[model samples]
Target: MCTLLWQWFSEVELNSGELYLYHNSGTARRAINSNKIFGIGTPRYHFFNNLFWTESWWGNLCSDPPNWIGDYNVYVRRGESPLWDTQKNQAQAAGIDLHGRWAEGEISPYRDADEEDFRLMEKSPALDAGADAARLDGSPAGNTMACLFGIRLLRYGPGGSGRGPRRRDPGRLRARALRWPARE
Candidate 1:
């Protein structure tokens, strides 16, 4: 599943199933699940260009260890003592939120979140803040806006491919391409 531009008003939790270790009576065996967030499911989940903010002191953002990959996200907490460290440590271990920024006043990435407008403003931290999508799962880089636009243009404009547009070069994400990692 490809998720983008999502805003979570409450805490977010991820399930990674369970893990088991097997070893021989006298031999050593190593079991590693580097790219499996669930430890038993396909590595097909991705999150990008999302914002998370909460006013409660206990609100948190979490994800299962290992597997899941993401970037270009934001997390903010509003309280006397914000537990930003906990949020940062957890995400870093999961290869996600590598470039995610933290803020207190800039809670929303849109011009005005209360007005139901998710469009990023010129000075919004998320305007050009995103990671390379292909690195996560062979997806295009950038925020949800660029992604949605690319999809629409590729599918219904010029020569519609139905399956999505194909080109000699897949090209990198545009518009909100600021700080995007160089294409490989």
Candidate 2:
């Protein structure tokens, strides 16, 4: 039985859709799954610059889709499992996650996941791991917009003092910049 974190059913149509610059962590099952008819599933699903971390053996990253385009992402697994390596290798061989890397560490890239602080650590490999925003086909990934928004919110929003440094990093949030302020 394959449990999925994000699943697309056969009824939904996703053409030229892009999924990028997101961060998915924790003990979920598969990160992405799709319903297939015959052997082909959805098409034109592009994934880029995302991070996936899992602590369980059931944490398969993606299902095999014929035209899925994925790259520049990071995959991290905590415990030892042959299934994890095998599935990852199969995904690569099947033309998924071509430029993606398997981050090897027991420690999470985030500062304190247990505390719900999804900030990237100073030495995190995911710091500069994202692809250029302009290179993506669609409107830039939400992460870029969120970073800009987060900055504005911090500088000009309600309690903001309107005076602070702004920096940018890869992944879901402006984690490195927001969490660890830049030093003079």
- The C-alpha RMSD of each candidate to the native structure, in angstroms, is 16.3, 11.9
CA lDDT, every model vs. true structure: 0.39, 0.50
Clashes of 1: 0
lDDT of 1 by residue, 1-184 (tens): 2122123312344323221111100101111224322223323233355544444212212233444344565544544344456655766765655766655674444566668675555555444445444453355654443332121233445675444323222123322322322233
Which number leads on lDDT? 2
Model 2 TM: 0.54
Off by over 4 Å in 1: 1-43, 53-66, 76-83, 132-146, 149-184
In the range 61-158, model 2's lDDT, one tens digit per residue, is: 34443445566666677666556877776777777777676776666777887898877777665666755544443244443342411112233467
Candidate 2: C-alpha lDDT: 0.50
Clashing pairs in 2: none
